[model samples]
Target: MQIQDLPYPDPGVPDVRSGSRFLWWLGRNQLGGQIRSMAWGLLHFTAVSAQPFCVGYAVQAVVDRSGTRLALAGGLMALCCVGIAVGDTFLHRAAVTNWITAAARVQQLLARKATQLGSALTRRVAAGEVVAVSTGDVEKIGWFVEAVSRFTAAALTVVLVCVGLVVYQPALGLVVAVGLPVLALAALPLLPRATRRADLQRQKAGRATELASDTVAGLRVLRGIGGEDLFLDRYRRASQDVRHAAVRSARMWSLISAIQVLLPGLLLIAVVWYGVQLAREGRISVGELVTVYSSVMVLTYPLRHFEEIAMAYSFSRPSARRAAGVLSLERSTDTEGSRPADVPSGDLYDPDTGLFAPVGRLTAVVCGDPDAAGRLAERLGGHPAEAGTTSVLLGGVPLDELPLDAARAAVLVQDKDPVLLSGTLRELLDVPASGDVEPRAALAAAQCEDVLEALVQGSLDAEDPLDARITERGRSLSGGQRQRLALARSLITDPEVLVLDEPTSAVDSHTEARIAEGVSRLRTGRTTVVFTSSPLLLDRADRVVLVHEGEVAAVGEHRELVLTEPRYRAVVTRETQDEPASATGPETPSEAAPITAAGTAGATEADDDGAFRGALEEIEETA
Candidate 1:
């Protein structure tokens, strides 16, 4: 494959059983490119190898004082130069194309697998390792793939050169035949040590990268808890470890490089000295001795390919293994079967959790364990806790059996901590069209006017909420603001079944109550399941189910459940002592005091004040 033909339509299913197999699979996919590269490489090396013979003939012609022989030698030299130029130029082009295309194909396969695995990817592989493999490891694998053809050509040239020497001068050819193998094999013993150090360096670097990524992602939280310095120190230590490992790896490679240079130098000295003795003894003439000496010098170049090939394979093997490991992970939830595109409308049920979200109703799941709640939320969206653990049935049909796109279209699950991608407010809310909920309605239901106002800060179009840009992961916004914005985005999707996990945990009690009322009003007829412990949201739900010991323990209205189930009360109230405090709670949405125009205006004014001050600060910085 060429560079222009990159990003293969289907990178093909990889043979990821082992690293070697994966590397072989890459080679097999690009067999045509490899052949082209190898052919060019052979031409280039062969042309280069012929230069020594031309020089030898030219010297002999000059010694004989023959004008005709000199002219012919000059002609042969010119031809060799042209061949070298064409071969070298095209060889480089073909080799680079193979390298880039191979890397692109691996990256495509990795990205596709990552999308398929979803959240389960982190569980199967370290986030840091995945990053390393997709970036550094991919380059190393491509390097090996591209080097293979060149290495083959070099080895072939060395063999042919040795054979030519043996035919032209038997004594010198024997010396070269014996010396070249020794030179190539001499570094074999040191390779194991070098490879071990390289693996160690790779491991250390991956850990450091992972730590840096995690530290950056959690920087806001770390600063909030006054743990930024602690994490910084940890990262510093990790960086130091990586540096040490790299130095050790470099030392081993340096030793190998010395061996490569030292052995070739000794072999050159031996060949020239032996050829001089042969000429002195009349075993070979002056022209033949010069040719033998030049041939040995030329052989030195191709001989280095042996060391290069070894190093490339050693490094790429581990990289390919890591890449294969990531590719090997299957989506924990089944993605098989060719089912129909449409799913019937019915309640969503997970047999594993024994929880059912009734159709066209707002159901609240109150689980004491947040982990259990998150797992149940994932299951509701057809992502089981484990592969084939159990089935979540939608309309009495297994969710896993449904086509993946159809299943996803039928349900939307919002995680407890959702990420807002870097983009304008409009782009952030841009999701697949579903029901009637518009961006405005969704933002209102999510109680996110403050968020939009906050995003408008320090902007040229200060009044245009949709045009205001959000930083990566909405890091520029407060925790509450980010949470509300995520809720708004989710609400905008307006899926038939919307599963929310702790959707309003970051918001205040008053705003949470308003959001609960707004969500209930907006999702009047759609099936919505919320996994939360807040009393405000629980009281707003049409029905409440308490999950305990991994299964549905009790099902009833919020008030009856709080009154009857102590576990439910403790979980919803956040403590045993707070259970009685819920007794005098508001009875209905109206009693909870709906979001008033004046209240929203006040919130907007407060947000705008913050935005205005931020704008002034930005202006000062620009000035």
Candidate 2:
């Protein structure tokens, strides 16, 4: 594909069997571009090679004192100059096109793979590695792809020039032809060391990049915990390691370059010395001596392409391997036999936990362990801990059996710390939806009016809140603001089944209550499963399931479970008291009378609110 038609509709499935294989696959896919570049390269090098011949003929003509031959030689020299100009221009254009298109294709493939894997991509590969592969690595790979064609043309030109010299003047021709191979092979011994050094530098650089990424992502937390210095020191050491590795790599490559220059200079000296001896003996004319020396000089130019191609391959091999590693990652739901499964009309069931959210109902799941709750939420959305082991069934069909798109469309899961991508507010909310809920409505439901106002206030041009630009990862916004915006985006999708884990954890109690009611109102008929222990959200749920030790312990209304199930109360309210509570029998007046007593229930709720606020404060501090 052309660079202008970039972002290929399909980047084509890459053959990620190995790094070298991946590079080969990329080359094969862009064969047409390679051929075009090679054709132009051939023309350019051939034209350059002809210049030496033209100069040799001109010198001979001048020595012969023949006016007619001199005029013909001058004309050929001018024509060679024109050919050089035209060939060089088009050759550069074609080479650049190949480089840009190759890089673009690789970028598209990485993006597609990232989109396909979603959160799991980071889990399988380091965030820094992904960044490195998509950025610097892409350029390196393109460099190698473009270098191959030029190297081919240069090699061919050298061979052709040597053969021409052999036919024209065998005495000097044999000297150049034999010396050229020696010069080319002189750097071969150093290449292995150079390649190893480069690979080591790449590894160190990747680690340093990952460290820097982690440090920046948690900079605020590091500052809060007074650990900034510790991380900074760690990063400094990593940077030093990378620097040392880079220096070593550079040293080896520099030595190879020295060898290339030294050997070629020696070859030129030998050719000139031998041609001068022949000239003195009257075995070769002054014109032939000049021609041999000039040809050897010109041949040195193409000889450097040999070292260049080797260096390019050394740097790009590791990059290709890293890119291949990322593309090779598969999501838990990815399977060769996966097929489209219709949206289920029945409950979303987690067979592993015996937990199910009935169709068209808001179900609240309460688990003592937040980690367990998060895993359950992911499983409900068809992303189990392991591939081929998930038993989450929708309408009696395994969720993992469905195609990724179908499963994602059928169930939308928003994790506790959902990320808000950088973009205009309008663009952030512009997602695949059923057209049932408007962006404004979703924002209002998620209590994001204050967030929009903040965006407007922070904007330099006082643009509309929807038009304001968000920094990467919504880092410019507060935690609660980011959380609310993420919720709004998820709400706009209006998927068949929406699973949220602590959707309002970052917000205060009042905002949480409003969000709970708003979410309930907006998702009236759709099925939504909320995993939370917040009383505000649990009270709003039509059904609450209490999960203890990874299994459903109780299923009842929030208040009913709070009074009847001690385990549920302990888990939700963080209550330490182990007082026995009636399970099968109705509540006695002593237990139920407090609810009817004036201001008594309010006092109890105030206590619960205080406890909840304390818990939130602790979570925020820990974060």
Candidate 3:
């Protein structure tokens, strides 16, 4: 497809059996572009090669004193120059088009794969690897694709030029022909070493990128715990490793480049020296000697393309492999028997843990192990667990058996750490929805009026709060604001089933209670499942399920469980058996106020929870 017709209607199903196969698939799809580029490249190289022959003819015409032949030679020389200019311009244009189109095609394919896999993409592949494939690897693959046609054209021109020279003067022609191959092959031995070094450098750089990504994502927490320097030092070491590997790789490539230059110079020297001897012996004319010299110089230019093609292939091969690896990932629902069907309204059930969220009710899941809670939340949305586990079913139909779009429409899972993409507040909240709830209503339900006020006050343009732009990942806002904003976006979707994991983990107790009531009021008749340990949210749940070691351990109201089950009380209140029973008493709305308003107002729920858990553990040990 042409560059203008970009964003292919269908990028087409790629052959991802291997990296080489994936590259071949891309080439086949863009065969028309490759042919167009090759045609222009051939014209350009042919016109350039003819210039030396025209120059020789002009000199011979001058020696013969023939005005007619001299004029004819001058005309041909000018004609060749025009051809060279036009062909060169068009050739560059075509080659560049090929490069851009190929890169665009790969990017589209990667995007499609990411959308299909969703959060599972990062689970299957490293985040850094995905970023590298999308950014750097794509460019490298395009470079190789674009280089192929030029390399072929240059090779053909070299072959034809050698044939023409041999027909005109066999003695000098044979010398040039044999020397060209030797020069081309001289860098072969060093290529493997260079390629190996390059691969090593790419690996080191990917590791460094991953380390930097992790450190940045948790920079706030690191600073809170005074561990920023430790992470900074680790990243510094990784950066140094990448730098050293890059230097080693560059050193090898430089050696190869030196050999290429030195050998070509030697070949030119030999050709000139032999041609002069042939002229002295009266075997060849002066025009022929000059022609031979200029021809060798012209041939040197095309020879460089050989090294360029080699370098491109070496770099792009690994990139293609990584891209292929990511594209090959399949979701649980991608297998046979999975098709789109109307979803019936019913409860959400995870057979693996025997935990079910009853329809038209708000359910709270309390699990001490955060990891277990996260996994359970994912399963509730049809995301598969380890192998051999039964799929979560909705209304007696396996969620994994339904098509991805249908499944996502039926159930929406907002992870604990939901990301807010950069855009105006309106754009951020503009997602596919049932259109029943207004943005303002969802915002109010999420208790985000304070967030809105702060955003307007901080905005320099005096735009409406909804029109204000949020920084990337909402970095300009506090953790609680980001959390509440994400919650509002989820509430707007108005899905049939909503599963949330620690939705209010970053807010204070007072705000958490308000958010709990807002969520209950907004989702009054819909099935909502929240995974949290907060007492306020737990007390608001229609039914509370306590999961222990990946199974449902207790099922009852939040207060009933706290009064009856010791384990449940310990988990929810962060209390030990040795502590006074009143400490674990059911917390009423009025009694759930902040311990100290001044101290708790500024402390996030996560920090408060961590401290409470730590203190409870210490008490248990002392008792």
Candidate 4:
């Protein structure tokens, strides 16, 4: 299949053709450019091939003892020199174009594959590996693609020169042509060993890259724990390992290169020696002998490409394999018009824990295990739910069973550290459901007034409210600010089911309390599952389901559970009882709050009875 037919668009795939055949594929891709380069190669060969003829003519002129003819040969030699120089100039130029265009095609393919894999990319491959592929491997792959064209032209030049030598002086031509195969074949035996060495060198290099990436990502934490020296030592070791591997690889190549140079020079000497003998025997004229010597010498260049191409192929083979591994990762394609099954109307079910947030209720899940909560969110969003351990059911349909896109549209999981793509603040809140929530309300609910104040012009310039400049991943903001912004983003989507994992963890108590009120006020009559230990957020929910040992161990109102379940109270209150001192240990902003129990035990029949009241009130208030 063509590269286009691969699971994703990476043009570097091997096709029905092996080396040359695959090259032909690229040639076919940019036939016009290849034609131009070929023409240049031909011009180069013509100019170079004429020199030998000119030399042979000059010798013949000397043998005939004709001064004028010899002078004429001298002039022809000068013209051939000019032609050779000019041809080589343009030949190199055209060859560069061939290389660039081929690399461009492969780059496009890799980019497309990267987009297709999306989030699953990191799960399937190391982040550093991807970084290296995009930066380093892309160029290496491109180098191979372009090398194909030069090798092709060089091969053709060698063939044409050898044929001309044979026809010009049959015996000498046979020597030059037969000797051509020997120089070309000399590098063959070294290829396998060279390739194995190269693969090891590249692997070692990747390990080094991975080490650097890991160290940089955790530089802050590493320093905090006094582990910087340890990580630094590991990095040094990895870098040294890479250097050693590279040296070993280079040693093998240098040996092959030494052979490539030595054998070709020896071959040239042998051909010249044979030609000189043939000339003495009267089988060839003086001019024919010179032509034989020049042709063999020039053919040396193209023959070298034969070995160089072999080496380049060896180095790039590993890169190709890595790129292919990335492309080979299977991606789930969401079919059209599919909705999640098993979700009974609007209920959310965590199949892993057998926990159900009854239809249209505000259920708060407090999982002691953070990982379980995160996985539960992924399951709820219908991402590839892990077999046996992670799965959520909506109605009768298993989340993973539904199409990925359809399930995602129905259920949105806002990760605590969700990335804020670069754009305006308005753009941040304008999520996929097309910013269904009003900007003011979402910003207020997430207690993002400070965030909005920080943004330029409050994103009012665009007709859309969500347009605000957010640096890559919202790096301009603090952890808490970015978290609240991400929360606002999720709230604006207003999916049928909203799964939030520790959304308020980074915010202050006041902001968290406000967020609790804003969200509980906003998402009434919809299914919401929040995983948090914050009493403020827990109190706001209709019911708090305590997840212990990977399963739901307790379910009740925050107050009832806080007073009864010691573990539940310990988790939410972070203590067994309130302080006896009116210091009540620093009276919490949570104390006087109703639903102050879970922080929003505020989930009452009367509260949700006015489910749409918040949306209506916001519309009236904003107006």
Candidate 5:
């Protein structure tokens, strides 16, 4: 099957698997492969069953001393060998196809889910869990799925062999028939405990993966703060915990394995001892005894398969559940009222927080905390939020009430440090369509003429930097450069409501000035919301709303805010840049940016020179 055909997440299909139902669904997707594999497996198993019968028949012929009959028996054994070779080859071939297709289907589901959830996915799910699910979890699911059919075939072969033995030699048949069930049931009691251990181990492993991913993603920030060693130590501790869990899981499975071997060994002994006694009593002939013994030995192989299938189930069920849990994450919920596409874009209101952003104007949101700004942006975009997941109204209708596609189509929330995909500059710009913005017009709008010159001089874009090759995540570009490119992309989209979060945070003053100017002009006559403490972006906005304590504290233009709002000034200028004085996690309280202070633009230096930034910190703290 083609990789795309796998029932995975995509633009059209959001990933939404609930449990093993997903894995089973994958098998259903490749019904043709499954049917073919099952057919081959049945034939293979039938051939396997015949091998034991052939041995018993050959033994009887040899004992009779019928030379011609003996030759025919030998020929039959050779034919059985041929069947084993052919059947085994085709069985393995079909089995591998099944395994690959199952995994591909799982991968597709995850990919599609990632798309459906959009930015919300990263917020709720850990990066590491996502990684593990796509890479490791998919295969584990596939392993169990492919193993199921083989196990089915092996089980059927075991049943047929036993039934044949009972009919050929009634006394031996009864012992063999009863022995098979005992072997199959041997692992049943241990299965539950083993499954529990496996689940714990899998959950721990996912968490460990998340920790490692978090550490790596934050390595740069951690190094800046001299917290690398601390994070490293934390990672090492997590790794050790995962190792311990894995060891516990392995121990349980190992115990199960030992039991499988022991039970089968006992069964073999019982069958052999019974057959020998039957021969002594003249209840079964020597040839009959050899055939029964061979058949029982063959049965051992399938019995071992039954044990393996149980173990695979115990191990993979936990991983499956984890994958299902991710798929089952509640997506953004829409409210009852539907917003009209042509509602004449006006004030956007948030019902939960009682916050409102008036339409057809440049509105700057000044949140004491940048995170607050980001969350509000989420609400503005009609993104699914918690009970208070910012329910902003557009034209009297809540943003959440609009259909996702229509809302997204109307309002674009350009996040802080929006991800830049690998491609040429133009390729990046026209993400939605084969779009090409007139180079000069776009560069002037983004104030990226300087960037364009660099791109062209360096021969980055023989076509233009706008058309130049941008590496994955645009790593080849500077931090500020990537940010501008993202802004440019957003500008090109030209949506009605453009919500930008700290858009100019990374750029220098000159570039920031140009972008601020370009943004105002490009978005003229449309609704534009810029979330920033930068006076440049703030000064340009038609109105500014300062949020303190999760509610709007003040509303006015930049100059009005500076004079009227003290906390707003502290945040706008470098006046009060106090952020925890040290490190704190998401749970810790953080000081919001205070009132607008007089200063142009520069990157945050509060972390490096606390004493120099002390007064600035005090102003924000006082507020």
Candidate 6:
């Protein structure tokens, strides 16, 4: 396949049985490219091999002073040179095409698998490993694939040269024949040690890459905790380790390279010395001795290819194994048993936890463990990736049974740490419109006006809110700003069910309260399942269900639950039972506000909830 026609319609299932098998599979897939490369390579090497005979004949003709023989030899030399030029040029072209196309195909498959796994990908494999596989590993695999055909042609040339030398002059030919194999085999004994060192180098490099990625991603957090130097020092040590490992690997390969060169140089000297002795004894013609000598020298070029092929296979084997490991990951959800293609219409329910979200109602789930809540939210969205787990059903039908596209379209889950792709704000929000909800309306409901203003402040060119660019993962924005922007994006989707896990965790009480009220108002007739422990958010829910010890502990309105259930009150307040519960209700913002980590430890929900409600009220009044 050509580079431009890459990303095959179906990248096809890879043979992940083993690394060698995967390499073989890649070669089998590109048979035509390999054949073309080999054909041109054969012609190129054949021309190189034929040159010695022509030069030997020319030297004999010059000694005999025969005009016709000299002219004939000159013509033959010119023809061989032309053949060499043609073969060498086209051989390079074919080899490069094979390399690039093979790498492109592997990259496409990796990208497709990454998209299929989604959030589960990082959980299964390290992000740095994935990066390495897609970038450096792919090149190694392609290099091996491209080298195979050249290796074959080179081996063929070596064999043919040995036969011609034996026929032309037996003594010199035997010397060449015996010496070539030894020269090629000389490096084999050291290859095992070299490969081990190379593998160690690759491992250290991957660890360092992962560390660098994590450190850069959490730079803000590290600086906040005054631990930036600590991480930097750790990364420095990792980088040094990688460098040391690379140097060791290079040392082994250098030894092999030295052996390869030294052996061939010794072989060339032997061939010339034997041929000169035979000529002195008159056992062979001067032309025959010269021919054997030239042929032996020509064999060196093809012998080097043996070393190259060995190196390529050693490096690419591990790389292929890594790629295969990634491709072998299956979706946790079983997409079996034929089912309808349309989205099932009804309430969404997770059979595992027995959590039912009624249609057209706002249900709030309060889980003390954030990780558990995230997993539950993922289940509710029809991607129960945990093994041995049942599916989340909608309208009495399993969500996994529905076509993947339809299922995704029906339920939109906004992760706690949602990534905002780098693009203009307008492009970011220009997702598939699921309903009549306008983007601006979703933004207002999310209380992201400050985010828009921040973008303008960050960039002078961002006079237009839609024109503002969001940096990767919205890193340029504050945590709250990123959270609000993500919420707005989800709101704009307007799916049948919106599963939000800690949607307002980063925002303050006032903004969270406004968001809660806006969401309740906006999604009045839609199923909305929110996982949060904030009092402002829970108070606005139609029903609040508290999850404790991995099971539902209580179900009621936020006010009634707090008054009746101590566990529920403690979870929301983040306080011990020894602390007295305030008697104030949801409308009393001072007694019901959500506490921020930066806020006073003694500050009660009663103190902040009232302030949040009053601020919301004043804003509504002003509008």
Candidate that scores best on lDDT: 3
Off by over 4 Å in 6: 385-388, 456-463, 579-623
Against the true structure, whose TM-score is highest?
Answer: 3
- Model 4 / residue 360 / CA error / Å: 5.4
Give lDDT per model, in order. 0.83, 0.84, 0.85, 0.71, 0.73, 0.84
State, as a TM-score between 0 and 1, how close model 6 is to the true structure: 0.90
Candidate 6, residue 543: how far the Cα is off, in Å: 2.1
lDDT of 2 by residue, 1-623 (tens): 67778878888999999989999999999999889888888888888888888788889989999888888888988887888788789888888988998899999999888877766677778889898999999999999999998998999999999999999899999988898888888888888888899999998998999999889877777888999999999999999999999999999988989998898888888888888889999999888888888888888888889999999999999999989989988765564326655666578888778898899899999999998888788788877355444568887878778877778888999998787778788889889999999999999999999999989988887477889878888988878999999999999999999999999988998888889989999999889999999887888899999999988999998867876676887777666443323445336655532221122232344454454455444433332
* Whole-structure CA lDDT of model 6: 0.84
Per-residue error (Å), model 3, residue 579: 8.5
Tens-place lDDT digits, model 5, residues 1-623: 64345543431232346556655665566677766666677677777677767777777787887778777877887887787788788778877877887777667667656765667888888778888888888788878877787888887777777788788888888988897898788879988988888788788888888888777656667878999999889888888988998898788888878887887778778878888888889888988888877777777666777877887777667667767777777566642336555433777777665666667788888887888779888778877776635457777766666766677776789899688887667778775521444545655788777676666666633764566676767655667887887888888777768899999888887678778888888778878888998776777888888888887888887766665565786777556534323233334334333222323223234422333244344433432
* Cα lDDT tens digits for candidate 3, 1-623: 77889888998998989878988998898898889888888888888898888888878888888789889888988888888889899889989998999899899999988887777778889998888899999999999999998998899999999999999889999998898889888998888888888888888888888888888878788989999999999999999999999999888888878888998899889988999999899999988887888898888888889889889988888889889999888776673336656755798898988899999999999998998788788878877556878889888888888877788789999998899999889999999999998999999999999999888888888568998889888988889999999999999999999999999999987788789989999999999999998878887899999998888999998767866776787787765434222445535654443442113322344554555555444433332
Candidate 3, residue 574: the lDDT equals 66
lDDT of 1 at 464: 85
**Every model's TM-score:** 0.87, 0.90, 0.91, 0.74, 0.80, 0.90
24-84: candidate 4 lDDT, tens digit per residue: 5655776766666667766666777677788888889888998998899889878877877
Which candidate do you rate higher for TM-score, 3 or 5? 3
Indicate the residue-level lDDT of 430 in model 2.
86
Residue-wise C-alpha lDDT for candidate 1, range 343-381, written one tens digit per residue: 656898889778998999999999988987887887788
Q: After best superposition, candidate 3 residue 196: deviation in angstroms?
A: 0.8
Candidates sorted by TM-score, best first: 3, 2, 6, 1, 5, 4
Candidates in descending lDDT order: 3, 2, 6, 1, 5, 4
> Candidate 1, residue 4: CA error in Å?
2.9
